[model samples]
Target chain A: MKAVLPDDLCKIFSKAGSSGSWHKYLKVGDWLVLLLSCALVVSSYTLLWRGGVADRAIVKRDGQTIIEISLNSARKTRVEGPLGTTVIEVQPGRARVFSDPGPRQYCVQQGWLTRAGAVAICAPNHITLELNGRGEASYDSLGY
Target chain B: MTPSGIELPITEDDRRIARYTAAAIALTVAEAALPSPLPGIKPGLANIIVLVVLLRYGWRDAAWVSLLRVVAGSLVIGQLFAPGFFLALAGAVSSLAALFLAVQLPRRWFGAVTISLLAAFAHIGGQLLLARLWLVPHDGVFYLAPLFATAALIFGTINGLIAARLIRQVETI
Candidate 1:
């Protein structure tokens, strides 16, 4: 049974019979590439170590001034009203927004913006916060 | 029984095909290892090896080596059925087709690098077409600039030089 596949079709399945061999010459350029890949992987992991998101807040219209609720106050402190209940984890320096009335709920799913310069803004309710620092707590108004 | 029906040459042809196949795999692996900032842009380094094969060896050998490269390289990158793998395969096939045509021209006329550039362009064209059909159909044309400037020229030139050098070595052997 001799079935000759077309050249193009055969090419797609020819891996089993064709692997190239190379001499073991340690080129300086190859070494540089190894170092660079390692550096990129290490830097990304270092940036994520020890800290998840620390805190989150939702600002709702309360007549005059904007009111901020601390997400890390207590696990039991749940907010319920006309606006949907947003369960958040407020850490030392970071705040993770759970839900918001926005076009894309992408920000809410990105649990706990813990890294410095991380932010979640709900423009519909005029709520904003700058997530900063590591797991260290900075003094802010935590109570009504 | 197989597509290359000339019952596996046991002499010089076998040696030639084997050598070309090995070189193609090595180059493909190297290209696959490179960091791709975007989905499509590659230095096109493997084209250099393909160019050498096309110039020194016959088109048949070059075609065989190129085919194996796409298959093996895709598996290594863990992108076997992905769009990127098919893009690369199509590009390689198109590039090889271009190179074969270039080789049919007067050998003394076109340089290896010139042929390489043509091949590189063909590969890019294939990717763009696939992107239009499979990916964002509306904005596929937007992919040309960055791919040409950053990926094509940079890797194509590198591959050209490598091909030029290998041709010299193969001649001596």
Candidate 2:
């Protein structure tokens, strides 16, 4: 007589074999992990690529960061530069050089910087203003 | 003591580790040849071998195979002791740590696929963290998180499926 497992017992063993393998290998926990991983990957987009709204704006006078303003509450800050006092306006989601005593009002005319990596330079006043955020930058490189 | 060669005692476990390590290293070198559109993204095919060793042998032996693969593969690619080596080392160590936690789950439910997916995420997470801390030192490094995480998901699922198949073959044999 040939030695072999009983038919019923062998059925249970053969059921878990590699052929038609996905159902066999993906168990309860594995399925749960797959679901969670998919969800995580989906959520990463909203969390990481929230790049439009910059969180902070930095005011630099002659290459020195003088004020780091949070772009949450609306406010106005004036910084004295080589030309004169340069006014920067901050809104809930953006910042701009409101006014500058520079010969050319380039920074003021640049309008609102609503995206991370956005920048405006009041070159005549030697004051530079830029936005930074925790999220991804919109442009590969920003500023004129 | 003369010119006679001295033989160091090698256990069965040592031999098994050596063999698995060699396999993993070969996969790593082969995978390196594939061009990545992004700087740090790869399918991480060698992870299938690492997961197999972890399941067949144990965590410690699997760890040995994984780490040796990083060092040996780096050497083969002429990246030994370079920044790339450190990145690879971080990925290996973190994925092993994740695997160490994975085996704690019930084997009946958590098999090679689940184990491989967890390790894949851990590997990319570790590399990104290292790059943020030491390499770029900026939040911009994390700008690539979604990309890497997506890579981890797609490649992780594929690698896990292949690993699950291999583990089944190993079991039946």
Candidate 3:
């Protein structure tokens, strides 16, 4: 006795059998897009690396620039935002969100920021800190 | 298998949608359960169902399956109405749009792999845009774009090959 194939499986098999040639599916246009995407990724990273080191850290709260601190100086400041307060610390060419009034404390968990365009954001408190260096800022900021 | 051997009222399209959605949702949940080494990098195995649907059916069916997967997957992962949900929704919308446009290109010129790549890029791009506008609100967010793009390239190709192989297996059956 022949075993009966499931309907869904049968559908896939029959459909695939009747479909057009699979060998010719990829063409020059597809290759072009793939190559361009790869190039874009590579060039963007190269540009990021070339952005050099940052010397300043800018603090912002609720879309407003709060203060700019030189990374050369080690200091700490508190910024108030909608959610609450965030303590920002800058030390020897690097900065970080020392503490924030949030449950997760994500900004604090981001550790340190030393890159030219690295950022630490406390979304709940609407606070953002960005690093700036001697060289030009690379493609905006890294989005997660 | 019904009591009276009677056919179900569901149409073929409906059945296909249900089957593909189930597959995508399973993949999504499994992916979520796994620990990702990086923040935005995942294998995106769910995309295989979308690619297969697009190839066997059409964009309309594929869109339904993809969007349903995002919504249901988010719900399953308990992320509904959260920032993550919104980001996932945005990614789904953009990827579907990308797939729609990619489908317009001649099939011979672009296969599952190319379409997957475009969709993956669009997905990451959408998430980044949403993150900048709402979540982080910093230009620094774009710094992660290259990393996300690299992940997309790798996952997209792998998923595309899996879909292609499945399609070939189905044909052989």
State the weakest 10-residue window (summed lDDT) of model 2 chain B. Answer: B164-173
Q: Write the per-residue lDDT of candidate 2 for residues A1-144, one digit (tens) a residue.
A: 012322322343455543664666788888899999999998998876776568999999878999999999999999998768999999998999999998878888999998888899999999999999874455546221
Question: Fnat for model 1?
Answer: 0.00
The list of candidate 2 runs beyond 4 A from truth reads: A1-23, A55-114, A120-144, B1-5
TM-score of chain B of each: 0.81, 0.95, 0.91
Task: Please give the distance, in angstroms, between residue B43's alpha carbon in candidate 2 and its true position after superposition.
Answer: 1.1
* Model 2 pairs in collision: none
Q: What DockQ does each candidate score versus the true complex, computed on alpha carbons?
A: 0.02, 0.28, 0.24
Best lDDT goes to which candidate? 2
CA shift of A69, model 1, Å? 44
Off by over 4 Å in 1: A1-144, B1-11, B140-146
Best by TM-score: 2
Candidates arranged by DockQ, highest first: 2, 3, 1
Q: Is the docking of candidate 2 incorrect, acceptable, medium or high quality?
A: acceptable
Candidate 1 CAPRI level: incorrect
Q: Which consecutive 10 residues in model 1 chain B have the weakest lDDT in total?
A: B140-149
- Lowest summed lDDT window (length 10), candidate 1 chain A: A1-10
Residue-level lDDT for A67 in candidate 3: 97
Q: What is the TM-score of chain B in candidate 1?
A: 0.81
lDDT of 3 by residue, A41-126 (tens): 89978875555588899998877889999989899999998777899999997999999998899889999998777888898899
